[model samples]
Target chain A: MSNDIIDGILEAIRLLFTFDRELWGIIEVSFRVSLTSTFLAALVALPIGSFIGLREFRGKKTLSNLINTFMGFPPVVMGLIIYLLLSRSGPLGSLGLLYSTSAMIFAQFFLAVPIITGTAKAAIESVDPTLKETILSLGASERQLWWELIKDSKKSIIAGFLVAFGQAISEVGAVMIVGGNIRWETRTFTTSIVLNTRMGEFGMAIALGVLLISIAFIVNYGLTRLQARGG
Target chain B: MNLLKVSNLYKEYYKEDKSSINVLSGINFSINKGECFVIIGPNGSGKTTLLRILGLLEPPTKGQILYYNEDLCNISRYKKVQYRRKFSFVRQKPIVRNTSVFNNIAYGLRVRGMKWEEYINDVNDIIKLVDLKGLEKKNARSLSGGEMQRVAIAMNFVFSPDLYLLDEVSANLDPMNVKLLDDFITKIKQDKEKTIIMSTHDPLEAIKFGDRIAVLNNGQITQLGTPNEIFTAPKDEFTALFVGYENILSGTAEMDLKSGLTIIKINNLTIVASEQVEGEVKVCIRPESIGISKNPPSNVSYRNNFKGNIEDIRDLGNTCHLIINCQSERFLATITKLSLNNLELAINSEIFINFKATDVKIL
Candidate 1:
């Protein structure tokens, strides 16, 4: 067993260095879906999160609790919910988006929104109250106040986005159920690893796993550098 | 003409349990342009709340604040922002942006859309004024507390607003920074176009900086007058103790037909005051006004003199506070370090305490 594992690792390294087209194609599909979902999710989540964080209104606590509950939502459960929504004879089925990249993006966007919103809300809430009063006393307009808050909490906001991106890129259960792991269309690093392992292609699975970890490390390192520079 | 008038101002905070706490009530005062008004109060006295209301950051629960005859409480949000631009407020704790010191100081100007070229000279001048010249490029969050306060002051000073509201801006500052802030405020006080309203618990600061002082206690303004009047004649017992009057005694007074002085007798000591009052009264005498000497002078004009034993001596850094016990009555006398040493005063030593009749205030 040890000798087999060593052979599989050596083959994975060789395949990675040789720029295997199928492997890179799977990586591209994974990034395209995750990045699209993360970007769209941020656009919707950031403003709502900041508003909920800064303002006190009726039922705010209940809304905040609901968002926090959704942060821990299971990926497979979410996939099932999206699958029903996009399936034929369902309410949203007229769009015919099932088993496609868009369906996978939709599932991942749902998975990432609550995570981003919850983290961003916490980040904005952590800003010093004195800073808010000081800005207001300086006669900050509504637009200027919002701009200052965003600038002040930019590091945490970026960290929130990175967290959502990490969750989206590594998620497999939802995409597998929603996208059906279609060849060359919705095949991602996570789903391909499972598929290759099931087919006894240990070398390919190991290569995908190593590539996934490397991508996570690179993204996290870049974001950490950005946060440090901001500080 | 009054620049700002606050009438019947009141503020109450409600808790989650539906209980209400009255923080300030029935507050009424007006400030003139180019005058420095100081509010001296103890902790939890709603000084900051009052300052916030005047700064237009918080609205009173029930009252109206008029600025040049315009009701501020009824102004639109846009107009409120515009009115706030005419004044600057420095909070108790220095709050700076997590950016360069120069950018933090230039935030007010930048928010108003002033070009960098237009404010660069002014910002640099204020940087020098607050003694933050070398740290302009440093991150503001990395500075010490005093340095951060200087940055906060410089930020407000650069705006040169018509009214400046400060809330205990010198609370935690070191002596050097305190003097720097005092000097900056003194220079601003000389500018006739500017008005200032500040709050402090320090009586010396109130006396040194205020053209008019308001004594606030328990959410009420007990007395409002010039610094000399507040110091010389506090209206109540709380104000008397707050203003550093050490000897507060209840006595009965009657006019002396011969000398035209009110003679107050308290605990076997007869006190002659310049004021003419009858019946029961409270008298206050400042510690510094009493003269302490080793030997009684022969030809001096001091009227109130008593021979007492020095019960205690407190060293107050450049001044000595000597407690004299005269026939069961204790009087505190503050003398300079020079006088303290020249007289060789010590505990249990005999001393003569003297003060003029005019120094004793009958309240």
Candidate 2:
């Protein structure tokens, strides 16, 4: 068993060096879907999060509780919801998004939005209340206050964006049901790992696993460094 | 018209469960233009609440705040913004933006649509005014606490707001910073026709800077007058204690109608006050004005002098409070700790306490 594990590791390293076109296709698809979904989610979440953070209103606690609950949503449950929504007989069937890259993007967007919104709200809320009061007392308009909050919390907002991106890129279940693990198109690194392992291609599976981990490490390291330096 | 008149202002803070706490109850006062009014009070006396309401940062629950003959309670939101910019609030915990010192001071002007050149001249003058030269480009957060407070004042005062509302602006400041602020405020008062209203717990600061003094206690203004008036004649027991009237000796007053004087005899100790206050009087003597000596001074004409033994010696750094036990009375004399050490006074040593008759106020 030890020899088998050593041989598998050696083969994975060799495959990593070889840079197979099929593996590159999986990586490209993952990047394309994850980037699109993260951008779209951040675009929608940041303003809404800041709006929610700066205002006190009725039902605010309920809204915050619901958003927090969504943060811990089960990946498989999210997959099931997307599958039901995009299937042939589903409500969104007429759009023909089922088993497509766009369907995978939509699933990833759903997975990422709650994380982005929750973190962004916490970041904006963490800024000093006196800073807000000082700005208002200095005659800042409503629009100016919004922009000032975003400026003041730029580092934490970027941290929120990176967190959402990480969650999107690493998510498996939602992407699986929606992408269908198509060989050349929808096969992300995680989806390819499952597909290749089931087909008894252990070498490719382990190679994709290593690559997935390396990507996650690089992204997290970059973000954390940015955060520490107050970018 | 008074620059600001508050009639029965009240503020109630409600908790998340909707139960209310009354922070300010029916606070009322008025300040005329260019008057430096000081509010002296203890902690939690609603001084900050009154300042907030006057600055238009917090709305009063039930009353009218009229500024310049305009009822601020009914002002429209847009007009409120315009009016708020005309009043500046500088807090003790200086709230500066996490930006360069120059930017922090220029923020008000920048918000008011001033050009960069206009900001340049104005910021320079303010930095000069606050004596914060060579720190124009430094991050405000990196500055010392005193420097941060100076920048906050410069920021607020740069716009020449008609009213400068300082909320304990000298609290916890070092002596050097306190002196700097005192000089800066004095200069502001000298140059600008701005009305300055500040709250301070330090009686010395109030006595030094205030043109008019208001004593606030338990959310109510107990007395408002000149510093001398408040010091010479505090309305109530609390005000008297707050204004450094530490010695409150109760005794029976024997009025000498022929000489227009009242003599109080407590135990075997007799102290004469110049005023003809009738029976059942309490004589208040300020500790600073009382003298302490190991031996009695030569034939001084001051009518209030007591020979006693030192009961206790409290060395409070700058000053020492010596509790003296007279034959039938007790008195406190606040002398410098240096004087106590130089005199080599001990707790059980005999001493003489002397003050002029004019310094003793019989209430």
Candidate 3:
């Protein structure tokens, strides 16, 4: 609508096509921390999620309720919690992780794990109960049975991971509070977008947003193909 | 030795209202190795519960399942799985995984730790055996109901467990699929050491597959014996009516010592039975025992003859089930299709039906 807006749009496209080093650096950090945190979260979340979903035991209801509460937990609060734990003179201060990429990873890991666990539990719960009987009737052991269940819930669990990745990659509050958004060290897509917008560098922020979305699209497109072929 | 001795098994399910409904009560039977043991009953008669308990899918609420004289009632879940490896259970509904038919059939082998090379041919052979050779690559869930049932049977059959627990596998299948499954089951039964415990509500399937038949009703086993023994000599009124191929008529009985037989009077009709049961009695006569002739069967001294008219002619493939009305009394007589053709008997055809005194059972 305005000359300045038009110029910003043109600049955003130019920055993307020219492959700006600053923009790529931000993309690299974003993917590195988010991917690492998502991967680590899945490792811990999957077993806990599957165990809670499949078994009937004492305190199952309370456990499920607690995980569900964590699923909707605010990311800023998670950041504050990790900040306090890693801050100097706090309980876990000896590691000197605060204001580092590792501190950012800790905050994001706490934020991502609960979402993945909740989705994994729900996915496992939705598998056909009769299929479990069929698996056991084949003389499958308890481990084999759970493996079959996990395989059955593969699509939903992967979808949950994608959601967790999305949340971690676009995160600002947690990484900012913990890593201080130090450029070339802890600055990721969301924190960089926040800083660039504050400085009236809207074109760069918008370009980074487009690239993040394009990456999400590519991952989903690949998984869609995989889901179709799997059937 | 008995492969399994189920002694006084019971199962109950509690509803949301906290009231318990009994599914099985004091069920008792012993199955020998290689025997085709069939538990036949009406729907809701505890057949499924009994089969599920036998397969170790569920524990009995009371009593014991002695597997080879070792009580399995209190075994650990791990131990139960070890024992389950010795058996294969084909559920009533044909439930399959959302995978290739080949994988579904190979499932048992995979769980048993058999390599793909070791089980591939066995799976292929079973696919061919169940008439699903080319469909192995097809997704199992995409198949038709009949095809699903075939895959379900092949899934269990490929591994050849020591015991087979089939719970109404042919209950809702098409005739073609049922025949294929029945043929495959017959082949399995041919192995003299592979025990099979099949449950069904179909009397024909019971007669066809059972080496020993147990008739369950109202959560209890009313009768258990060879098909012949169970059919000919059902001990109670429930069994007599359940397996009603035999025409059971309530009548007043008088011991006729002069003729060395008991006389049963039904309505205005009189029948003679070899037994000496007195007072109110049930006169049981197998349809096959009754003879149909154009003329009265003469000089058959022990025979009871009646002049009747064929009221309904039911063509049962090779055998014809004829309902004859003799002076307002009805009788079910089964004659061969060839005999019906030779006698030119149709509905309303005049005929004489005769059953010897020994053919009738006084219960």
- Ten-residue segment with the worst summed lDDT in candidate 3 chain A? A222-231
The weakest ten consecutive residues by lDDT in model 1 chain B span B226-235
Q: Say what the RMSD of model 2 is.
A: 11.5
Best by DockQ: 3
Clash number for each model = 0, 0, 0
Query: What is the per-residue lDDT of model 3 for residues B1-363, given as tens digits with 9 covering 90 to 100?
Result: 888998988999999999999999998889889899999899999988888888888888999999888898888889888988998999989688889999999999999999999988898888888888789899999999888988998898888899999999888888898879878887887899899999998876777677788999989999998775676456787886787675656679998878788889998889988888887655668899999889877787646899999888877699978888888877888889999999998889999998889998764
DockQ, all models: 0.51, 0.33, 0.63
Cα lDDT tens digits, model 2, A93-176, are 889899999998998888788888888888878989888878777766666777888888888888888877888888889899
What lDDT does candidate 3 reach at residue B46? Answer: 90
Q: How close is candidate 1 to the true structure, as a TM-score?
A: 0.78
Backbone clash pairs for candidate 2 read: none
What is the model-wide C-alpha lDDT for candidate 1? 0.88
Cα miss at A158, model 1 (Å)? 1.4
Give candidate 1's iRMS in Å, 1 decimal.
1.1
Residue A207's lDDT within candidate 1 is 95
Model 1, A29-147: lDDT tens digits are 99999999999999999988987887778999999999999988899999999999999987999999999999999999988899889878887788888898788777687667767
What is the C-alpha lDDT profile of model 1 across B165-261, one tens digit per residue?
A: 9999889889998888888888888898899999999887786678899999988999998775676456787997888644666679999999999
Q: Of the pair 1 and 2, which is ahead by lDDT?
A: 1
CA lDDT of every candidate: 0.88, 0.83, 0.86
